[model samples]
Structure formats: structure tokens, C-alpha cells
Target: MTGAFDGLKVVVHVFGKVHDAGDGQGMLCRLDLEGLELVATQHRVEAGASPRTVRFPLRTTEISYGGTDDGKLVLKTPEHILYAERDELEPELKRLGLVSLDHVLSRERQLLGGRRRKGLAVWVAVLAGCIALAFGALWLADWAVARAVDLTPAPWEVQLGQAVLDGQTWDEVTDPEVIEPVGKITERLMAEAGEHPYDFRFKVVRDPQVNAFALPGGGVVIYTGLLENADTPEELAGVLGHEVQHVLWRHSLRGLYDRLKWHVLVAMVLGDISGAQELLLAQAAGLMQLSYGRGMEREADRRGVELLVRAKIDPQGLHDFFGKLSEQEGTPESLTLLSTHPSSRERQEYLKELIEENSGARYQPLDVDWEGLQEKLKGGAGIER
Candidate 1:
């Protein structure tokens, strides 16, 4: 009737659950675009029954028509996908002013490709940011730790050392008589140490471990075991000299920094000055138990020998002390000095080389009664100066 579809006869194959078409095969149909319907004039039926007519609604705006690989036209919609002869459908599409199937498909592909490219760029940027953040965290940690150490005030360091010793009583050697000779040696070493900001406190703990350790802010704790082992005042001077240099070089602070770097970075970033101070004070008491790295030990040894030379006490005594420690068995409790100091023949040889380099320098004795001090310690008598 030329009412909806241009009154043209077209052969079509429809697939899907449309209302009345019911998946007709090779049916002759007329399209009705105005009414959005497809009416079949002749469709398959029972052999004895009259030929049936069927109607299916068409949604032209939602239908997608494309050329198939087998030279047929295929149309797809949310409700149905249908096939028709290219010769039958192409003319109708042209008459309706619809673009060719190839143009529509190309536009869809371009739109999809643009979306994929945009998504890929976003993912790449996110990945780059994550990698940069990982490396930045590492670099920032190192730089922040060094800055924290440099910014610490001298008085705070002293207070940190005191906090470590505030509560514990180790029956430490407080007798001035026993302390005087040790103080004399320390004073001689400091005289040549040049100007410094620390008020050095030296203490002798009554423990029997052959070890001595230095605290930040100029606290040096020596065990009686170390004193008992030393055969000469010069050897004791050597050990004190080494410990003194550790304080001067701030090795404890450096070691403490390694432990607290991440916390320091976080605190500095948040500008939490009081939190950082509390952290340092809380954690620093463990400094006495910390072991220095090999590089730090070497630096302390090298600088300590130089100090001994300036004081003109024999530098060979340090070498001899190392030799004695190296001879002792590595018993865990009794030989803590050996364990911590890592005494070796290689270190003794290095010390020998240092002394020989200063062979031309005149050496004098430290005027202390070494034998009498040992006898008192051996006799278990309280020393009186």
C-alpha cells in the first residue's frame, strides 16, 4: 500500500524471538519503516495448512546493518539479528539516505580505538608515579637521617646519654682512688683532642666482661675486666683513646640514626619536633648495647692512634692490647670485647705499621702505678688514691 515500507517485495531470513515471525527462513517480506514493522507475505507452515502471514516490529534507529563475509547483508538489534540478500537490502538502505555499512563500522572502530588509547595513557602515568615514589622514599630516608644527626644540639646528646643511665645501678666503680689514674689518662688524651663541646664523663662498671663502650654526649663506660687485663697504663690509654674518638666522631649517633631513619623522616615531614626528641631520648639507652660497624671501628682506631701520638704515650700499647685480646678464646660472656671489637692479626699489623710510621717521635711513659692498681683489683680491696 506504499503506506510504511515502500511497497517493495524483499526476501529475508529473520532469527530471534520476535512476536509473530518465530524465526522464519527465506520468507518473502515487505519492510514498513513508517510503522516500524516487517510483514511477511509468505512464510513456512505445516504442509496441509494455508500459508501464514507474520509481522515483526522493526526499530530502524537501533538496528545495525553490516555486509557479511558470505556476501549477505546482516542486521543486528537488541531484540533480533536478521539476514537478507545484499541485492534486496542495499537498495532500500540507499533510498532511505542511510550511509553504507562500511562507513558505520569504521566510525565505531575509531571511537573504540580512541577510548583504548586514552585508557592506556592513564595506566602508564599511574605506573610511572608509583616507581618514582618508591625511589624517592629511599633517597629521602638517607638524606633525612643525615640532616637529623647534623641538627641535633650538643646538650640534647648529653641528656640522651644521661637518660640511658638514669635508673640502673651496676655497682659502678665510684672510688676516686681507682678513678684518678683513669681520669688522668683521659685528661691527657683530651688535652690533645682540640676544642670540643662535650663534657666527657668517664665511669668504670664493675662487670667482668673484657669490653668497653662509648655513649653519645661523651659518656665512656669501661669494665673492670678491661682494666684487669691491661699490663700497662699505656695500653689502657690506647683503649681509652679509641673509645674517646668514637665519641668525638659521633659514631653512636650515626648508628642510632640508622635505626631511626624512617621514623626521623616521618617526624621531620610532619614537623613534629617534640615527637622526634622523645623518640631519640627513648631509643638512645640501647646505645650501650649496640655494636659499631667495621668501618666505624677502623676510623676510631686510626684517629685514636693519632691522638696517642699527640699525647706522646706509646701507640704500641694499642697494638699489644689487640694482640692480647686476639689470643683469648671467644667465650661469649667473658670475651665480649673480643666479640664486639673483632680483634684480628690484620688489625694488629695495621697498628704496627702506624706506630712504625711514628717511630721517630719520642715516647714517654704515663706516670701511673699500673702494678698497684691491678693488685688492689686482684685483692678485692676498695681503691683509695
Candidate 2:
């Protein structure tokens, strides 16, 4: 049977132990609802079982349960539910705040929803602002780094080359006999190269790898393997001349500047100098992995040929060296050079053509002490040569 209130929707705030007939358990609750109360006359199921349906009627805006001294359930009309005992009803109704229940629930829902929306909007705006600042910071950092540093690969590269050489001096493998000869060759080349803005230095490393490289600080390093392969002084001079051109052009600095520009941009965005430093170090390491571009390689080669011609040395020495290196194209040692500076065949052909055009007529060749250098390199006990 339908009880006192059946069809009305009610917002509830329950308190104390309310039996959930469906769930088969007693629940502590605080229910604030108008026109709804638990049905009293419904058949009581087992003590802990949930009722299929609540059968009581609600006649008032407020109610209280379990208020009787004898444990009998009572329904109060239109406003309140009171049990048969006055002593039981007085304490529970007062504690439940039945007088102001309806007003509190209505105000709570209104204020809570408005505050939630406002807080969500504030968080969204903050997130958007952070994103914009990140991009702006990166842009400013990039601009600043571009203005502050010059990364062109030039004479400074030679300094690094020298440093690498100097570092080798403390090593046990450095042969004292060749030091003087290497020094003499470097001095002569520097004098012939003429004065420029960058401070240049040359190094002869003890490595067997046939390679030479320039650093950003005017340092040029030539490996011993390359030196041993040169049958004539002119061939060695050609290699040195080409490396010197790389230093003069500041190619190392240019590569560094390009990579560092992006790093500085990131640093600016983050407002951290440490990030910039890390980026620079990483870029420096990458510099070793770089090879001169094709145009740059050709320019250096042409310049070197010009230097040898002006120095009264035969340019054929360069072509011969390139020819030897071209033969080892598939080998592991030669792969390093090819990987960085591709077009070995093309370069060799170009050098051969230049040698034909410039030195087809009979010309005197400077005598190079090749046998003595080779003997010295063999680790002989005496320095007779």
C-alpha cells in the first residue's frame, strides 16, 4: 500500500543508523528532505536484510528515527517525526538541527557549484600562461645567444689543435727525435701563411690514424700515420696547408654557433644558465663528429694548392696523397675521412687535373729526408738520422 508521501522527490541528509532495506545492513546517515520518511508498517525482514521497498509515508519537511525508549517506531505529521517517549524525542531532534535543515542544504548546493566553476577557470588560465611564457623564454634566449657568441670555424680552431698536441707531450709515446723536425715544419708554414687575426698553432699527434683536424681555437692536429705516408715534404705541406685554411675560414666556429644558438634559446626560456652550459658542452662534442662541407673542402683544397704553388713547392704532392687515400676507400681507417668529407674520387680527379695544368713542365723537387723519418718512426734506439 502507498504510504503518506509516495511520489515526491526529496533531497536527503541522513544521520545515526538508518537501515538500508535493499543492502541488508544498518547505515549511519544524515538525511534532510521534505515530505519523506521511512515506512513503519512494512513487514520487518530479517534483522540485517534490506527491505525490497521502503513502505512508510512522509507528512512533514523533517523527521527523526529511533526516538522511542521502548524501540517502537512513530511518524510525526507535516513537520517532524517523534517517538512515543518525550525523553527519547527531545535529544535526537535537537541534535539533528531539524529547524534549519532545508535552508542549509539549498544554500550549500548553490555556493559549492559556483566556487567549483570559478576555481576550474583559474587553473585553466594559469596553465595557458605557463605555456606562452615557455615559448617566449626560448625565443629570447636564442636571440641573446646569437648576439653574444660567434661560432664561425676559423683561426681559433687551430688553438684547439695545438692544445691536443700539447696534451700529448706528457704521454710516454712521444718520440723526441721527430719533435724538432715537426717544429721546423710548423714554423716555416706559419711564416709562409702570413699574419692573420687568429693565433694559429700546429701539432703532430702520435696516432697511427691517417687524419688531420682543426679546432675552433686555432689548433691543428696531424696524425703520425698521415706524416709517415707522405713520401715528399711537399705532400706533408699540402696537408698542413689545407688544415690551415680550415682554421682561417673559421668553419668550426660557424658550426658551434649554429648549434649553440638553439641551446641559448632553450636556456632563455627556462631562465637557467646551467642548461646553456650543458648544451654548449654537448655541441662541442658534436663538433668532432662534423666534417667540412663539400664546398668548404673544395675551397680549402684550392687555397692549399695556391699556397704550395706560391711556396715554390710542387702541387703534385697533394694529388699523390689523395690518390693513396683513394685506394684505401673501403678500409676502416680510410672510412673516417670518407664519412666526414665524402667525394674522395671526385677530389682526387680534380687534384690530378690541377697538377697537370700547373706543373706539366719539368720542375726541380725539394729533397725530403723520408728514409730518416721512417727510421726514426720505427723506434730505433739511436737517433743517427
Candidate 3:
């Protein structure tokens, strides 16, 4: 009876000496077998439970009869029932309904291993995709910003900035005390800068934070705080020269270009610059984040020093300004410096080296009306006295 059966349900009967220890009664035993185990059992019988006597049904794959020997007879089923004189029945039960230990182990291992491999593969692919996306995003941003700057008209930038400044009259915005010195320095620098294709204009802002920035169309803003810190005209000139270089090289435009490069790529793919314009507008509004590359900052510094030398101004001014800013590193004022420029000790050193190397060469100084320009700026409201 050690065989296999494929079925949904099985009923088995066991017959043997059966006694109900509970209530001092006898009971017949019948068991329901399912799947493989039913076919494994060798013998089957039927019986019931009663108070006086219990006749049990017995079903088993193997049976052994012992003459002149008393031993307990047992029946085993798929789920319950413990005692059974069924050594031969073991193989039959496994073949019919019971799961073999080896088979169970093998099935579990296969399932777990397959799941683990699948999970690992999925995670690896996702991680790789993220890395690729990050690189692609950076590349696209660079390209788009470049294209945008090329497309923007230089005159347009100047006009826009002029219009903004024009809306507020000089009397309403200029600070007399600071404006005078700043204006004097700027006039000399611009005259020294001399007829570059770009239209350069300088303005003094009343802010106390030490900072200076260049606009896309050669517009330079010098904060009063910077002028306050500058002990010499050379320092002011160096700073102004640096900002001038930023304008001449179109660094602000380039920065805008670099930042919006990716958006331009997307726009080109979509067949228009309109999308890029929208992105640029967002950036201008400070709604989008962008940063200039280190290379751009370095180039501005190098060129600024060159301009100072050409103007017969001491390049040491640039180095000194950078040195002072570097000293203030980690302070609130330093943070303001970092907003538009890279402040580093190495850069200051480089400027110093540049000045020393170019020391022997010199240029004629431009005749500038320092006092008159100062008076003009001083008359303005925002220009501090």
C-alpha cells in the first residue's frame, strides 16, 4: 500500500485496540487524509467511539503481526495521530501525502534564493540609473546656460539695468560721502578700461555689507561697506577692476549661461528658446539655484589684476582686498563675499604672484576728476557721504 495518490481529499479508517482515557470510554477512530499521505499508508480500517466499547478504524501502508506478543497498534494520518506500528508505513506515507524532508528543504532554498537575486538586481539597476541621471543633469545645465547667454543681446541687458536704476532717481538713492570716492575711482577705472565693446557703468549702493557684483551687461555695483574698508584708492581700484573684468569677459552672462545650460538643452529639444527664457527668468527671480564655476572666478581675478596693471594702478590692491576678505572668513560679512565670488587664501596668493611678475611693466595713469565725480555721487540719495 505504499503508493502515491493525487487528490484533493482522502478519508482513512484505523482499526486497533482503542480506548478513550477520558470519561473511561471507548471510541472508534476515523481520520480524513489529504494529498500524498493517504496513498502512502498500507492498511485502512473504520471504527467509532462509545461509552462501553470503542472500535477504531485503521488505515496504514504496512502492518506487522506478532504472535503471542502484546504490543500497541497505532495508526498515523497526514495531520495528527502519533502512535503507529508502521515502520514500513513511513516510506508509503511520504510517497503518498506527506512531504519529504529533503524536498521541503530544496523548495524553500530555491524560493528564497530567487527572491534575493531579483531584489539585488533591481536595486543595482536603480542605483546606476540615478548616477547616470545626475551626470546628465549637470552636463545639460552647462550647455543650456552657454547658449542662453549667446542669444541674449548685450544692449538689452544694459537697457534693462539702466531702466531699473533710472526708475529711482539719483537724488532719491545716492549716498553723498561714499558715492564721491567710489565715483571718482570708477571714472578713472572706466577711462582706463577704455572703449571696450561692452558698455560699462558703475553705481554705488548704500549697503554696509562688503560686497561687489557685476551684471550681465557690464553693470557694476560697489557696496559702501567695501569702500569703507578700503584704506587706499589702490584697493578700491583693484576691486573695481575685478568687477570690470567680470563685465568685460561677460562673466555674469557666462554664469547665467552655465546655470541655464541644461534648460537650453531641454528647450532645444523642444524646438524653442522660450522654455529657456522661462528658466532664466526663474533664476533671475532667485527662485532657481545656480552657481558659477571656480574657473570663472579665477579668470576674473587674473583679468582684474591685468586691468589694474594696465591702468598703472597697483595690483597689490586686489591682493590686499582678497586678504582682508579671507581674514573675515566664517563671519557674516564673509558669507556675503561668498555669495558672488569665491574667497580663498590661494587666490590671494596667486594675485600677489601675478603683481610681482608684472611689476616691471607700467602704463600711463588716466587724468580723472576725482573730486568732481565724488561731488556728483555725493549729491545722490543712496550714495552715502
Best by lDDT: 1
Which 10-residue window in model 2 sums to the lowest lDDT? 61-70
Give a tens-digit lDDT track for model 3, residues 1-385.
2355444555444332333343234333333455433322323344653323222223332222221221333433333332333333334444444545325434544655776689899999999999999998877777666666677677765654454445443322354555555666677677667666667777776666777777666766676566566656687788888878777777766666455565677786676766665565555533112345678778878887777776677788778877887887778766676666777777777887888889797755434444454444445444333
Candidate 2 lDDT for residue 63: 35
lDDT, each prediction:
0.73, 0.58, 0.59
Off by over 4 Å in 2: 1-176, 259-261, 264-282, 360-367, 380-385
Q: In candidate 1, which residue pairs get closer than 3 Å at backbone N, Cα or C atoms, i.e. clash?
A: 5-32, 177-385
Mind giving the per-residue lDDT tens digits that candidate 1 earns over 42-149? 444578988545444444423333344234555554444455565665556455543433465446557657766888999999999999998999889878777777
Q: Could you tell me the lDDT of residue 43 within candidate 2? A: 36
TM-score ranking, high to low = 1, 3, 2
Score every model by TM-score.
Answer: 0.63, 0.51, 0.59
Using lDDT as the yardstick, the better of models 1 and 2 is 1
lDDT score, candidate 1: 0.73
Q: Candidate 1 — worst ten consecutive residues by lDDT sum?
A: 12-21
lDDT of model 3 at residue 279?
Answer: 62
TM-score, prediction 3 = 0.59
- Deviating ranges (above 4 Å) for candidate 3: 1-119, 167-196, 254-265, 278-293, 329-335, 356-385
